[model samples]
Every structure is written in C-alpha cells, then in structure tokens.
Target chain A: MLILHCPHCDRMVDETDLHPGGEAHLKRHGPEADAEAFENYLFMRENPKGVHFERWRHVYGCGKWFLAARNTATLEVYGTYPAQTHQPPQTIRDTITERQPGWAWGDFR
Target chain B: MSEPVSALRGRATSGSVQVSDMGLQGMISLRCDLSFGKLKALSKDLVGAPVPALREAQVRNDRAALWMSPDELLFLMPHTEVDDALSRIAKAMKDQHHLALDVSDARALLRVEGPFAREVIAKLAPVDLHPDVFGPGQVLRTRLGQIAAAFWMTDAQTFQVICFRSVAHYAFDLLEASAKAGPVGHFPRGT
Candidate 1:
C-alpha cells in the first residue's frame, strides 16, 4: 500500500483512503482554440516512466484535493502540495532534480 | 415540522463493546475560511467555544465544535437548538462568503463504549487509534466499511461516530459486527 502525505490535512494517508484523479497540470483549451488543441487538452496525458505529477483527493480525510510528484517506476513520492498551486513548488522540483538528474516535463526543466 | 426522531430509533447493542444510537443531535455545517476574524468571533457566540484547530475538537458543557476540514467546522448541541443556532449563524455571517446550515437530521450519531472501543474503531478505519496518536482532543473524518464516517474519543473508552442517516442501519450493523467479533487483543488493556 502506498502511503502519501496529504498537504491539506497534513496526514500520511493510506492509498485506500484516497482517490486518484489522473494527471495534474492539464491546461484547458477553450472553445476559441482549434480542434487539435482542444483534443489534446481533453485526451492527451503524460504517462512518464519516471517522475510524474498527479492529482489525488483525500476522500476519507479532509476531503481536499492535492497534487503529488511521484516516481512511476520506483513508487517514490517526492512531495505533495495543495491543488491551488499552478505548478509543483520549487522544493519538490529540486528534490526531483536531485534524484532524477536531467529530468524535464513540458515547459518545466 | 413534526417530531424529530433518530434514525436507529434509539436502538443499542452489546457485544465486546457497547454500541448505541446517540439520538437526535443538533449539528451545523459551517464552511468558511478559518482565518476570517468574523468566523472566530461568530463561532464563539454560536458554539460557546472558539473554532477548533485542524483535526481538533473542543467540547464545553453541551456544546462542541470539531474541525471537518481547513475551511469547515461542525458544531454540535442539543437537538432542539438547531434552528436557533442556524439563525444566529445566518444573522452573524450575512454579506459574507460562508455556508452554514442545519445538518442534524441528515446524519446519525452512534456511541461506542467499553475497554475495547479503540480496537473496534481500528478494525474499520484507516486511522491510528493509539492513545498517543489519537487522544481526547482529536477528531478524524474517515471511512467505516463502505460508508463515509467520522469518529472521536469522548474519553479513553468511549467513542462517538457520525455517519449519514440514510445508512444508519448499515453503520449500526457494521459496528455491531465489529464488536461481536470480539477484541483482537491487539491493543493492551488500560493505558
């Protein structure tokens, strides 16, 4: 069982007590965007083999949604932060960079 | 507008632990930023206590306030006082971005007591029930079986559980079953 620290409740929550909300940081394309852009926004998702950012809900605890940076291969969680953040905080990025050197995703390097 | 009745009709069961319906309890769901000065002031008047810190519960006399989330609190009192409490909250929080409502009838309250009360709760919830981990002043919102529930220790050997009224029977059955299964001897007797 994967245990993750929920930033909202500040508790190490069990995986069974949380709900996975797929990928995080999906930029939505409004109606003004082209078909391809909207399609990418709706369907395209990152399934990286290494570090991944995902959304999770502490459904059984504080009932707040938060983001997590995790290593898909090793199941190592780098950090968790509130969903209100636009992107992972610098601390989490630094932690990930230290562990997985030369890691880059989208516009973030 | 009719008489208020508990979901379990005040039924109780005895096994290794005592499980009983706590009857109608006045509960108000107040959702607002906890840092708001007005909320701190209104809560003092509304519940006779300050807003509890995160995951904490403060009980004084017959009134109590428990933190449900960072921005939500549940206030408890006598069943007959729900309307008055809601009105007071409404009047105090007008022109503010807040949500306060009478949720007493929407949920069921159960009490679990006995030497093995902590074990019974541990069998279902994912939370740590050790005295050092979850003592008197802490409250947790978690799942009991397949239903959503919240629980807190009234003391070392007594626990109060809250779940939706619609599933009161299920919750009672779950608690009864857990109690009937007997203590696992996982937790030592006495603190």
Candidate 2:
C-alpha cells in the first residue's frame, strides 16, 4: 500500500484513505477554452519524461487539492506539496535526489 | 438516504438521551467551528499545530487526540483526560469559532482488543483492516455490520468505532457476541 505524507498535516496516510486524482493537471488557459478546445483538453496527454505534475485528492482527510511531482517511467514520487502555485514550477524537472534510485524519485515512506 | 440503520447505526431513544458507541476502546467526537474565522489558527490552538485533522481521524497526543475536518473535530482524549477535556479544548479554541459538542449523548464507542479482535471485526466490517493496510492515525467513515460507522485505528489491531447512539443496545449485542472470541478493550479513552 502507498503511504503518503501530507505536507500540510505531516501525517502518513495509506492508499485506502485516499483517492486517485486525474491525469497531470494541464493548466487551464482562459480564452482558448472553446467547445472543441474543451474536448481536446479532456483527451490529451503530453507524457513527459522528467518531473511531471498531477492532481491528487486527500479524500479522507484535508480534502484539499494539491500538486504531486512524479515520473511516469519509474512511478517515482518527487514530492507532494500543496497546489497553491497557479503554475507548476519548472525547477523540479531537472532535480536529482541521491537515494537508492540515485535520484529523489522513488517510493517514499 | 437508502441506508438502513443496522447494528452499526444504533437507534436513538426519546426518554433516555440518544447515544453512540463505536464498540471499541477509545472514542470521542467534537463538533466545533466555534465561529473561528480561520481554520489554521483554531487548529493550532487545539493541537500544537494545524495539520492532520479530519472526521473520524485520530492524532496522537500521548493520551489526547486531535482530528479536525473543515469545521468539526472528533477527539479521542485518553482515558485520563475526560474530566477536564472540554475545558482544554475550549481554551484551545477560546477566541476562535468553536463548537464543543457533547458526543457522549449521541454517540456510542465500543472497543475490541485482543489477539482475535480483528478476526471478530472482519465478520461485520468488510474493509481489509490488516495493520499494514489500515495504519494508526487513520480514520474511516465506513459501514459496520449493516450500520454506518466512523472507524479510527488507535494502534496495531486496536480500534475505536463509533456511531449514532440510537442503536447502542443493538451494538452491545453485536459487540458482546464478538467479545466471545476475545476480551473487550477498555471503556472510552478518558471519561
């Protein structure tokens, strides 16, 4: 089971108490959200290789929306900080944690 | 709601004040926003910090507990803190928007702790409650033995479950039956 530490609460949670969020949240761009645009928005993916951002919900607890840093190839988790920033930070994409995986992108306790 | 009041959703009576027991060891519920404008400040006052608070959840404070959701928090104060539990909690949210609800009247708590405690709970509760899956400090609002319940894992294989007080006696029957397989835990945490 996945145990996630809420950055806000600092408490560990099992997968049972959480709900999986949708694919990486693509920042919604105003003025470009037409009907056809909305459909494409819902059905598209940019499967990037490096640090990618996704939406996650702490259903059982805070129930607040947050951003999660993860790598698609390794299913590694970089960090799960709050989604306060309107835009995803680009600095993380180049980070490398020196752990078992040689970088900070593996499953965390 | 199509939900049926089972052994978990205990019945409420008119003459005697309604009550709820989780049929577990430690249990307490607090409903308070207390008119506190901001959640972070109110929480910091209740607990030392404002993190990991939710319904049915438990935060370890030696003997006291803290679980705050958007508005309310259900505390499982240790068995020793009952007498003055309310005051401390009140002081925490003294200047904030707080509502201290006397859960003893509407909720019932039942504890099952022993080697086979989990075994008996499995009969009624369907969720996989193994230690690894349901870790400590986790709270769940799930159904128990046909009754909806809020389950909090206080320790390994130890649980504090509570529901509305209306069906307290019915829960007693089910808990008593489960206890046959193992001994009951302690009474409510504090008082």
Which candidate tops TM-score? 1
Compared to the true structure, candidate 2 yields what TM-score? 0.48
Docking quality level of the chain pair in candidate 1: medium
Kept native contacts, as fractions per model, are 0.73, 0.10
* Most accurate candidate by DockQ: 1
Q: What is the lDDT of residue A77 in candidate 2?
A: 70
Clashes of 2: 38
Q: Determine the TM-score of chain B of model 1.
A: 0.95
Cα interface RMSD of each candidate: 0.9, 5.1
Give me the TM-scores for chain A across all models, comma-separated: 0.96, 0.63
In order, the Cα lDDT scores of the candidates are 0.89, 0.53
Residue-level lDDT tens digits of model 2 in B69-136 = 55456655444344466666676667765566545546666655544455556555545555555556
True contacts kept of 1: 0.73
* Per-model TM values vs. the true structure: 0.96, 0.48
